[model samples]
Target: MKRTLFAAIAMAAIAATSNAVLADTPSHRDAVAFVDQAKIGQNLPVIALSIAKQTVTFTTIASKLGNAGAVKAVSDEINALLPLYQPKWNENIAQAYEKSFTEEELSSLASEGRSSKYASKVLAQQGVIGKQMESTSKPILTDLVTQALRTVMSKTP
Candidate 1:
């Protein structure tokens, strides 16, 4: 039993170390840098707000509540939560970049921004990339709106 437990602990440690190493791989780091260089996270709040506003459930709830104050409250809550959401969104975009481009391409993009030789390839794959981003972001957006609604409702009469 002691030997089995020791082996289990050793396996867990190796898994944890491998995850840390993978996260700092050249491609992953370059992807993150490229995301920053492209200013991808700068408009996240705006996009989140847009997504929230477009959500039918959110609008229906606000209309049923029949209070501009509630709408504003939800908006305010979303704004407050955006800072926490930004890093997650940036990481998702970075993962997308890592999947779509090689380490060298990511490094060049990070250094050169949109003027990199890979820019045209990126543009050509815009639809695919957009779908990938949207697929990942949909759940996060849903959660954001749900959280905002909950906050507003909890404060409501």
Candidate 2:
């Protein structure tokens, strides 16, 4: 019975150590650095604005109000809120980078400073990265647009 208990304890320790090593395999900081170096988050505002414009809630509100100024105000408000959400978006991008590349690859890409080769490597993996980001961001963006629309609608005359 003592031998069995000892074996169980040893196995538990090994499992915990293995998980710790796996968790750090592709460090989050390395992934974030790679994303920054690649300017991956630079277009987040543009993407957010585009999504806002395309959302049915936004369009319906604008059309019902028939006020250019109101539409612009809502757009401006959304843009203002973008900064608050940008960090979350960037963190998601960093996670995508971590999942798609190894620690060595991310470090190399970041150190290369967005060279053509680095761009090609990233471009090659765009589908995977894009899918990951879209799946994670869709709900968040939808909620943002929905809330903005509700706020505007509440204030409309």
Candidate 3:
């Protein structure tokens, strides 16, 4: 349960900050089109599955906190709340896309993504990039946290 909560929290934080990261740059129309044309929306199922897996993991952790009844209670609570959060999470995803890209970019990206070659190229690149990111995220996050702590400590004096 703890992992589920942490994953959800992490995803939410990423969704929240993603826009800010892009705010300084113009949206890539080709990218937006690619997202649409490639049927990337299929990832929603992956996201849902990830959440479900986290919930089960969380339930196990919660079970360890007390008796079996307490475990059931915690697990039930997570299951109940997750459904409620799903709609909002989905909306936030849509809004993030809408806010991040302009209509023109989206249209252009759509056309670009229409080509099988272009779509394939994009997907291949995405796979490589995703792997790199997965490998590096922990180190990057750790560095940032360490930097932040140093900044705070430096200011304390």
Candidate 4:
């Protein structure tokens, strides 16, 4: 009991310190959670953002923007699929991010350059958009798998 309490305190302190450095980058929070869950399982945490190297044809419309705008762009893309999957997404968040993000109460304004299946549909096109989707999906898929692994760990007997 003592050891578990100490470990929890340590995790909370480390998380608070880490969040200070990442106070502005909301996307980085997901990556950090991926890394944390990886650490708990003694796995490597260097998947890297696969989307960082890909090129895209779309221009962000924000007049004066920075990294925050870039984060907003990604959020917008995710929001576009909500109408088609928002019900499922709500359930997923209720199960997944229930204590963290207020997804059900908040409507997003971010719009993407394309849809969720953009990569599969345009794989042969060689358009910047196709590459863009591939780039984005890889790390997102990696994190998704990592979260699944975390769930498995949580249920271990």
lDDT digits (tens) for residues 71-111 of candidate 2? 67577666767777666666676777666677777777877
* Candidate 4, superposed: residue stretches over 4 Å from native: 1-129
How does candidate 3 score on lDDT? 0.38
- Top TM-score model: 1
Judged by lDDT against the true structure, how good is candidate 2?
Answer: 0.60
Highest lDDT against the true fold, candidate: 1
| Candidate 3's TM-score | 0.34
Instruction: Write model 1 residue lDDT over 47-116, tens digit each, in one string.
Output: 5555566667567667766647546777788888887766766776677667668889988998888889
TM-score of each model, paired residue for residue: 0.71, 0.70, 0.34, 0.21
lDDT of 4 by residue, 26-133 (tens): 443443333233232111111111222122311222223444553354344434433443332222222222123232211110112133233232233223322322
- Look at candidate 2 and give me any clashing residue pairs: none
Whichever of 1 and 3 has more TM-score, that candidate is: 1
* Per-model tally of clashing residue pairs: 0, 0, 6, 2
Question: Alpha-carbon error at 120 in model 3, in Å?
Answer: 2.9
The 10-residue segment of model 1 with minimum total lDDT is 7-16
Q: 81 in model 3: Cα distance from truth in Å?
A: 10
* All-Cα superposition RMSD per candidate: 12.5, 14.0, 11.9, 22.1
